[model samples]
Target: MSGAAGGALAGKRVMVPETRELEVLARMLERHGAEALRCPLVAIIDAPDPAPIEAWLRRFIATPPDDLILLTGEGLSRLQGVAQRAGIEDGFLAALRGVRRIVRGPKPQARLRAVGLGADLSAAEPTTAGVIETLRAEDLHGRRVGVQLYPDNPNAALLDFLRGAGAMPDPILPYAYASKEDDARVLAMLEDMAAGRVDLAVFTSTPQVRRLSQLAVPDRLRAALAATRIAAVGPVVGQALEAAGARVAVMPEDSFHMKPMVNAILAAIGTPGSGEAA
Candidate 1:
C-alpha cells in the first residue's frame, strides 16, 4: 500500500473483497490508506454438475474433431481434470494430437502447451473481434471448430456471426453460473452506491456484469453506476462494463491482473502515488 494506492490512498478507503480470496489486492489497497471493501462480486464454481460435460467429453474424445478452439484457460484446466477422471486423457490427446489448436490468448496457450498441445493460432487482440479476424485469416470457414467457452461468455453472438459467414462453430460450454447468492447484500450495496456512499468500482470478469444486471438494480443506482468511473482489467471485462452502462476509466493492456489493473486505475485518477508517472 506504500506505493501508488498507498502513497496517494493512505487516507482514501477502497473496497476489497470480503471473501478473503483477494487478500493480495486488498492488502495493496490498504497500504495506500484506501479502505478495501471486501464484498465479493461473484464466486467461482465448478462447471454445473459435471455430468453433462462428462457426456460431452465422452462423445467429443470418441470422435475428436480436427480443430480445438480454447476460449479460456480455466475451462481448459477443468477439462484436463475431467479428462483425467474419465481415464481418457490419452484418447483425448490422441484425438487432439494432430488437430490445430486455437487459443484466445497467452494464458490458454500456456495451458495447451502444458497438456502437450501446440497452439496453431491465438487471438492477437483477445476479444471477439480478434477471434473473428483470426478465424478468417486462418480460413476456418467450413472447418469443424471446437470452442471451449466461459460460463457467461457472450459468444452466442459470435457463434451466430461465424455460422452466417459459413463457418461451422461447435461451442462446448464447460460451466454455468449459479447466481452469487448474496442477493440481499448486493442490493444493499447498490443502495449505498446510489446514495453516493461508494467512490469507485472494479470489474475483473464479464460474468460479474451479467450477475449484477440480474439484480434489476434501481434506476438511480444504475445511473450512479453510469456516473461512477470503473476500473476494468481487460477488453472483455471492459465490454461487459460498457454493456452494463459503466463508464470505464482505466484498463491494462495485457494480462488481467491486480497489479496492472491497479496501476491503470491510479493513472486514471491522477493519484499522486507510486504508480502515477512523473
Candidate 2:
C-alpha cells in the first residue's frame, strides 16, 4: 500500500503537525499520493534560560554522576552545542563518558554512537515506561543520575521512579516548545478536517497534539478528529492523541521512525480497520 504508484493513500489529504521534520514528512506523504497539509503547531527552540543547562554541565564536569540518561537525540545534540558554545565541548564529552549512560531510545543511542560513545543500557520500547522498567532492574540505590530532557513533556514518572529507587535524578531540559501562532493557517486546517476535506492527521510528537488541542476548541477538535482518521508516529504520540480525545487509527508495528510511520499510515489507509474509539 505504497502512497506512490497510486497506492492506498493516493490523493488523500493528510495533515502533518511537525516542525523538526515537517518538510521530509510532508514530502514523503506527497510522494504517496497524499496532499500533505503542513500545519506546524509548535516550534522546538533552545531553552530561553540556559542557566540550568549551564549549571548542569558545570556540575557534570566537576563531579560525574553514576548514570547519565539520554532521552532524545536532539537533546544530546543540543547539549553538545551548548558545550561547544561554552568552549568546553571536549571536557563535556569526556565527563559524559566517565559515567554509565542509559538511553531511552535509538535516537539517543545513535547520537552517543556518533560521538564514539555507547550506551550501557537502552530501552527496548523507547518510551518512558520502557525507561522506568529498564531502570527498575538496575541497582540505583544512592546513585546520582543526570537526565537530558525533551521539550514539553515533563517525564515526572521516570523521575519519581528514580527517586523511589533511591537515585538522585537531575534533569536538564535542553529545549522548550514555542507556540506557532499561525491562527489563519491552523484554523483553515481545522476547518478542512471538520468539513471532511482531510482524510488523515499525522502527529509525530505529543506536544503537537497538546498544542493543537489548546489552540482549537475541544468540541471542534473532537468533531474534526471524529470526521478524519488520525495517525501517530509511535506509542507516545498515539497515547497523547488518545488522551486528547482523538482516535488513533494507525501506528507502526515496530521501529517508531518516519519511514515506518509512513508505511503504517499507508497500510491503515489501504486496509481500513475499526479504528480505536474516540
Candidate 3:
C-alpha cells in the first residue's frame, strides 16, 4: 500500500531493533512517514554444530513422529537448509508429510505452505501458553512429538507439559543467537530514548528485550524506556517488556505481525491524549 503524504505516522521516529525482517519492518514504517531508527541488537545464525541437527533429521526420517511442533518459521527453514546441504531434503520432506504439524503462529503456517504442506493444528493465541492450551485436548499419551525450537529459549514449560501428557518430547535447535557484539548500538538507542529523541520504541521479539536488559543497568533501562512509548508486536513480546519493567503502550488487538503492529501504532497515535509528538 502506498503511504499518503499526510500519513498517520508522519514525523514519528520509531525505534526498530535488528531482526531477520529488519528492512521489511523499516520500509513499512517509513512508508507511513515515520523515521525508523535502526538499532542492531541480536543476530541469528545457523547452529554452531550441525551434527546433532543432522542426527535428528535422520532419526526423524527413519521414524516419523506422530506430531511436530514448529515454533518459528526460521527454525523450519534452517532445518530445511541443513537437510538440503546434507542431501536429505527429499527424505526430510517426506517424513514431514507423514506427521501432524502443529504451529505456534502464522509464520510457521506460512512456511509449511511454502513446502507444499499445512498445519494440522495452530495455537489459539500464538504463544507458548496458547500452544499448550490448544494441545490440552489432544491424546498425547506415548505419542512421539518433535519440536522445532529457536535459539536460547529452552521452552521448558512446553517440554514439561508434553511429558506430563505422556508424550515423548524430541526437540531440535536449528539456529542460534549470535554473541552480543552490538552492545554499543543498543546503548546508543537507549541513550536516544532517554533523551526523548525517539517517539516510539517497537520490539518484535523477546530476545531484543533481553539484549537491551543485559546491556543497560535495570534502573537506567527502565528510566530510558519511560521516555518513549513502547509497542510490542504481540502479547509475548509485550509480556517480556513488562517483565523487563517497561510499560507497553501499544499492541495489536488481534494480529501480531508487523503490518498489524504498524496499524496499532497509527491507531494509538491518532487517539486523543495518546502522548504522541505534536
Which candidate comes out best when scored by TM-score?
Answer: 3
Candidate lDDT (C-alpha), each: 0.69, 0.85, 0.88
Estimate, for each residue in 59-173, the C-alpha lDDT of model 2 and write its tens digit.
9998999999999999998888888888888989999889999998888988999999999998978899999988888999999999888876688999999999999999899
Q: Give the alpha carbon lDDT tens digit for every residue of 78-161 in model 3.
A: 999999999999999999999999999999999999999999999999999999999999999999999998877899999999
Between candidates 1 and 2, the one scoring higher on lDDT is: 2
Cα-based TM-score, every candidate: 0.82, 0.92, 0.94
Model 3 segments beyond 4 Å from truth?
1-5, 179-181, 270-278
Cα misplacement distance, residue 210 of candidate 1 (Å): 1.8
In Å, residue 203's CA in model 2 sits off its true spot by 0.5
* Clash count, predicted structure 1: 20
- TM accuracy, model 1: 0.82
In what order do the candidates fall by lDDT, top score first?
3, 2, 1
